[model samples]
Target: MTRMLERAPNLAILYPRALVKRGGGHELPDTRLGLRDVAVERERLTEYHRVCGFGPSDTLPGTYPQVLAFPLAIALMSERAFPFPLPGIVHIGNTITQRRPIAATERLTFEVRTGNLRPHRRGRQFDVVTEARVGDEPVWDSTATYLRRGAGTGAAAPEPGEVLPTTAVWRVPGNVGRRYARASGDRNPIHLHPLTAKLFGFPRAIAHGMWMKARCLAAIEGRLPEAWTAEVRFAKPLLLPSTVDFGVRGRDFSVASGGRPHLTGRAVPAPGNATPHPG
Candidate 1:
């Protein structure tokens, strides 16, 4: 595993050069739509609906982004031509903006890209920006930071800021990890393969980040009002067979697993003119 991490290429190599070089600048591809023909048997929205501790008919779980985003991320990351090593990298953080509510039946395309790559003060660490679009409409954008084990400058931590508004909390069950993997077709060994996770230094398979996100949305529901935008930062990985507490307080919502915070962020109700909730 260490050898694999050492050989991992920089994320810059993963950019679709042909696409980026076209028109003299980085250009995102046309939206690529995906059909919802696949039946959702295991990790169906119904399961999350119940776990969210919300009543029936509430908006679809926010983590719905995983249904498309995770697959898209995987597809791009797995492209042989892409530079980064799939097994060597860790997903350090994620930020999502929901331009519109996602419906169970809506056909959606994903527009993905490896954005800016900047070196962190820590020698081997770097941050990569990624974005996803639904059709011509931009749906979500996120920036993820990665630490290249050998490359850090070893600088002191930055100072802290005033406390942000708090989010509500909901409890996540231990068994959902397997459930999400079964439903999302994201049976990535790191998430479901115990041996694989141990090799990667995790005690056990972890819950999909999207699953945790979905739980956050369910926690806030009517508390956030319609059309609101929420942005979450993953602070830690949620290990398998663990329960999480999630909720929105003031403008913030959080998910904590094994007594450690996994994700935290603020949400704003969507503007009146924004897209309405889809059934």
Candidate 2:
């Protein structure tokens, strides 16, 4: 069942709620959290565009709705019923499908839920799915796979063998996390500062996985079809203050630094017959 919110939940409050629920249950929640008729926050969107290297456009970035729906996603995961703690949950993969280009002015309804609990070589994994609708027509949706490290299962996750050929390079600054957090409202400490990150086992602060995805889409923005799906696997954490190479072959892409792959993904446009109406 869906529970509608009067407004976006304050992340300031939700983060603490998640921390407090650290030792919660092992079952995923069935409740779907939602919000209706929410307009795009133009200022935040602009800041996001700046940080992610996206060009200005009348339409929303394919990943924008994910950030907009993120608070709801957290609300679902922070509940006492959620299995794992939010602090160390690593985002392992993400997939975003846009039925069509959504205009910036469009008001959207969003719903978020969690499920797909499963085992991994290093831990347990689950999905947080978010869907957005313009009126009653579904415009966009995304699934973010997160993992909580603990035990072993089948084989270890596959690794990207050799680095893809480079097409461009990016110099990611240390403060990108703070900039993105301000714009996207995902202030996970691991992405915030080296001190905070060390508390999570990282030598230095890392970049947001979604930020990497957005930057790649921005690099190839003109080539993306109006209706397409983008999927990516986060191979390794992108340490901040790094220089990374981006490679693309056909629809496939990867981001790497010093031949170590950080992310790999593909973008595939929907077939003409499968494209949805923009309105």
What TM-score goes with each of the models?
0.67, 0.94
Residues 186-217, model 1: lDDT tens digits = 66566765677787788887777766666666
Candidate number with greatest TM-score: 2
Largest lDDT belongs to which candidate? 2
TM-score of 2: 0.94
* Per-residue lDDT of candidate 2, residues 198-233 (tens digit): 988999999999999999889889888888899998
**Local distance difference test scores for all models:** 0.51, 0.87
lDDT at 65 for candidate 2? 93
Q: For model 1, what is the error of residue 252's alpha carbon versus the real structure, in angstroms, after optimal superposition?
A: 0.9
Model 2, runs deviating above 4 Å: 155-162, 271-279
